[model samples]
Target: MDRLPRLACSDPRLTRLIAIYETLAPATLGALEALFAPQARFVDPFNDVSGPAAIRRVFEHMFETVDAPRFEVLDAAIGAGGGAFLLWNFHFQSRDKQRTPRCIQGTSHLRFDEQGRVLLHQDHWDPARQLYEGVPLLGGLLRRLREHLAAR
Candidate 1:
């Protein structure tokens, strides 16, 4: 689990961003045009993209690859200068029927423009625990490696 700096949630801008993310879906990706600036940047463990279309594409891809993908915003903080941090869990079921629904806990750091549209979004999470550890052969190998490293 990565620790993130705490932020206040009193800012309405931050509140709106949280709401948008909590209710986000591929069909409602159009809502991003209102939540994010045209040139807003988004980055995560797997993606580094800018602009609303590119960002929407990321979410679209998630929908295409997963089942019932959703976000649950757990907490948030608002900075004095339009910066915010959100702690959330991304819940989804794997495309493969054998796999069950899982939750990936992560934190989003966002910078909003003066008008309250997101200007930048960065995410931090542990891929080993959230993703790779659930894989088949790779899961065992990664778990062993983690144990080996932790013991040293």
Candidate 2:
């Protein structure tokens, strides 16, 4: 919430994050270390990575099959200070070519430390759409059914 970027690429910390996302989105293990303190904690529904080493492990395991990672920053707003959230569309290819380059839209909430390095990096997205639904066979259909019930 603090240390908001004025532009998606302006802040040094944000820049590092974007650079990592561009090159390592699916498999960015060690690259993340540069963004956080040695003991920083990162939490997502799938993982609660504590410390740099564990976070790196999560990234390494995540990148196992995801490839050709690319990001499209659709919209952003620069604040008076040094931070911002860019609505992003993350597209990538999986080893399962049948469902290659699936587009998953998400938001990365990043903050900077006093030194302007990323202190907190949080992400928000629909796990169903970005992940579960992208699986093969009944994935999409199953997601639809879940959505249908949730709407009730």
Candidate 3:
């Protein structure tokens, strides 16, 4: 697999945020309050919520559902007007005895507040291809549907 080139970033807040993501764990969930604004909004394919508490719950649920879930920041860039983008790969294992490992590639768009805390964080990724396509029965069905829908 080709690796993405990591971009150099000078912004301290963006650097800190990236570090937080790369090192995230159940013990570090408390750090969200410092990284996000009181009313920050977080949106992903599965959850859409506002505030640090709600965002914490989202991560909490992830921890409960998966084993050893972690994020690998492949590349990051700061955008104009206090915005930033992060390309990341999420790695985890299923909770079952087999513990099948999975990886999901995604990107996050972040807008920072004046205080350098995240005001909005939106994640973009394809659930059908990255997630559901790996399931047993569902995976086969989705692959068949995808083949059927493709241009011949």
Best by lDDT: 3
Say which candidate scores most in TM-score.
Answer: 3
lDDT of 1 by residue, 1-152 (tens): 44344434677887777777778877788886578798999999999999988998888898889898888777887767657888888889887867688889989999988787889999999999779998899999999999888955
Model 2 error, position 78 (Å):
6.2
What is the Cα-based lDDT of residue 45 in candidate 1?
A: 94
Model 3, 28-115: lDDT tens per residue?
A: 9988557999989999999999999999999999999999999988888888766899888999998777999888999999998888
In candidate 3, which residue pairs get closer than 3 Å at backbone N, Cα or C atoms, i.e. clash?
none
Q: In model 2, which residue pairs have backbone atoms overlapping below 3 Å?
A: 4-82, 4-83, 5-82, 5-83, 5-84, 6-78, 6-83
| lDDT (CA) per prediction | 0.83, 0.65, 0.89
User: Which portions of model 2 show Cα errors greater than 4 Å?
Assistant: 1-8, 25-29, 75-84, 97-99, 136-141, 144-152
Count of residue pairs whose backbone atoms collide, per candidate: 3, 7, 0
Error of 3 at 104 (Å): 0.6
Worst 10 residues of 1 by lDDT: 1-10
Model 3 lDDT, residue 141, Cα? 100
TM-score of each model, in listed order: 0.88, 0.69, 0.92
Model 1 — TM-score against the truth? Answer: 0.88
At residue 117, candidate 3 shows an lDDT of 92
